[model samples]
Target: SNLETETEKLIQIVLIGQPELDQLLKKNELRQLRQRITISWELLPLNRDETRGYIQHRINVALGKGRVQFSRSAVELIYKYSHGIPRMINVLADRSLLIAYTMNTKKITPKIVRPAVKDVGGLNPLTTWIDSLWKTILPGFLALSILLFGANYLMLPDFNKKNVEEKDLNLIIKENPIIPKNLIISNSQAPIIDLPQSGNLALEKMKPVTPSHQAYTPDDSLTTKLLNPRRIPSTKPLIIS
Candidate 1:
């Protein structure tokens, strides 16, 4: 400010800060500095029309004029969620583009923008109101419903404890009668040692107990030798004494 005053207001120094900067500048210690601030402008959020234009301008610059398109509803939703903030608008727009690209669509609609807004961490006015309403009313509604149900249940007459009528076993069996189908029976070529009475017995009888050569032993000499196991004299003669 002094430098600007010395130079006859030729030099300009701009001070930029958040919304709270105004409160900070109004403090007693900074009164002189605040007074010297000739031009004081609060950066206000863009209105609906300006927001739409800003989004369109960004789209045109990033992806040529006609390459991508945002639907009217999508733009409105973006404006509502972003509250006309350019940074948030950019974030939401980028996410919407990504969602549309993933879905293989060129046009962005509200359906595409809604999830983007949620992911970008902002809810439009209507959505915020609805969410709050649910939070406020749902528990009360549920409690009322439960109370009504309980009252209705208590007002009802006592139920009879008598046993229910037994169904007719014969009628039920007859209604759902089991009908046997014609079963195919195959014959075996091998000679039968005994007639099998059951499926398991038939399977066991069909299995070969021994090989044909082993089953047809001419004599029991091998069996006798294995059973006796007698020791024979050695053929060497030097230790005969």
Candidate 2:
């Protein structure tokens, strides 16, 4: 009965040995199920010569099981990038094959692999980054320049001085009196007119005498007539007193 039970369990067992396959089986097992599998192996990565052979084998398989050629430099570049990982070698070889097909060539070289890898991962130079930065900043710098020029024009003292001078000229012209041509005295040099010292004496000397008073006659209607003219005059008489 024990032998029958052992045979039955052995029939139920599934064999798993590959590293990737074992990892999957371990992940899915219950604790009781996990204890049943005691046998395992830790797979190691390929060495340099194995890596080279792996890369060549994949390239040959991609070329329909025929030989695909590669330069020593190209093999070196592949080894450098893939670093002895079988999966990475397969990925790079597949890409190199596609590049060879597109370029219409059977041989893959370092040049072909370089451009293929570069297409996936490439970096710009520092100069390119700096140039892009300048492009972004240029418009702001230009606008600041324009603003400064406008401010300078507005603040200039010469412009203010000219404006003030024009206003002053207009004001000066407006305030002076207008003199008629006939009233203006035309003299090479203006004459200095002198007056007498005393105000009353100057006034008396400048006064004009009447002609009738200056023409007085004492003989015509005598002194006696002059004294009695008003009493004796039935007619009007002219007398000097």
Candidate 3:
């Protein structure tokens, strides 16, 4: 009667376990009481696109619905550094926010994200390894490349011609590689005038010309000059009485 009642009121039970537990169960060292059941769903890490939302969610929680912005570059860097793990994202985000706050910054820039990721522990080992590759290995690699290039350059055979005699060398030293197109050669053209020789040859533009003085005195007879020039005869009005 109890078995019949249990069958009539059967409740669906779900179990969640990791791959190691499954392996143990298969080895018979560990066993599920109900035996074989279906594996329905597999959860995977959040992807890069999802990680942005995840970070925003955590940041929203932290800010109590206030507005604090994350630069797009900062978000991309966080995604790359965290590899889309929620826990690592949380750690990096928290550290980054703390860093930004301590630095009195309002937005999370890429510069802030990089330092925060480096400082945060529990980040994926691969991410840390890649970061280290950039920090330590890259400079060394660049130096090695430069060294190799220099060595290759040095090893090549010298193709230089033999040095000329002293007289020839002197002549070569005095000789200009480029001939002046406008040399003052004796010709029909007038001989160039001797320019005023000085360390500072004053350019035509540099000479300062004195400005013309303007007489701007106000005339006392301004009103009469405009209309009626009321002039008095200078010779006592020619008193011919």
Candidate 4:
């Protein structure tokens, strides 16, 4: 409950900062206490010459009277960046003093002020952001591109077959027919011995007789008499009987 009360007070304070605070206060029971406020001031930014004067005054106060010095170029840059705003002028003046002290110089130049503003505000160039993005994303994109190119190449029809050479031994054999020796012989002549159609019966049933059963005679006439023995001996035998 205490925290809620504190939160409500903070919200009231913020709401009062708005232009409608007078109308809102009429609705609240604490209007008498809120209306007791007497003085108010609305702060506004300084003009360009006033901005330069403010910076000079702050620097002179910090470094003792007539002790510190600044170039015209430095004062012009401060006016340009602060845009005649008193708050911004104070900030720039303080930073410039610090830079002058560190560098052991009495003059606050535009160069020193620029770097100090960038350092405090964390300003980054657009090109630098772009370069960082490209550095992070380019390699992956290039790798994917290479992979896509390879896929496309594989998907395409193979038209690089001009280097291929084919040899046909069957075609060569057909162009030059071979004729066997048996096929060249005429039918009127005896058939070739090596072929199946020779029809030579001597070669089909030829058998060798054993030496024990073979008839042998010294002369051709005896061989013929042995083969066909005469019947004269049979006549002599019948007479004796």
Best by TM-score: 1
lDDT of 4 at 94: 79
Better of 2 and 3 by lDDT: 3
User: Which clashing pairs does model 3 show?
Assistant: none
In candidate 2, what are the lDDT values of residues 127-157, reduced to their tens digit?
Answer: 3356777888888899999999999988876
- Candidate 3 yields a Cα-based lDDT of 0.66
Tens-digit per-residue lDDT, 93-190, candidate 4: 77887888999987778878886676558433223457777988898899999999999999987667553334466786668879654454343333
Instruction: For model 4, name the residue pairs that clash.
Output: none
Q: Give the Å error, residue 126, model 2.
A: 25
Instruction: State the local distance difference test value for candidate 4.
Output: 0.62
Best by the lDDT measure? 1
**What would the per-residue lDDT of candidate 3 be over residues 124-191, giving only the tens digit for each residue?**
43355677789999999999999999998899865556532323765774585554545424444333
lDDT of 1 at 210: 79
Q: In terms of lDDT, which candidate is stronger, 1 or 2?
A: 1
Q: Please give the lDDT score at residue 201 for candidate 2.
A: 49
**Runs in model 3 with CA error above 4 Å?**
1-28, 33-40, 61-63, 122-241
Q: In order, what lDDT does every prediction score? A: 0.75, 0.63, 0.66, 0.62
Comparing 3 with 4 on TM-score, the higher-scoring candidate is 3
**Ranking of candidates on lDDT, top first:** 1, 3, 2, 4
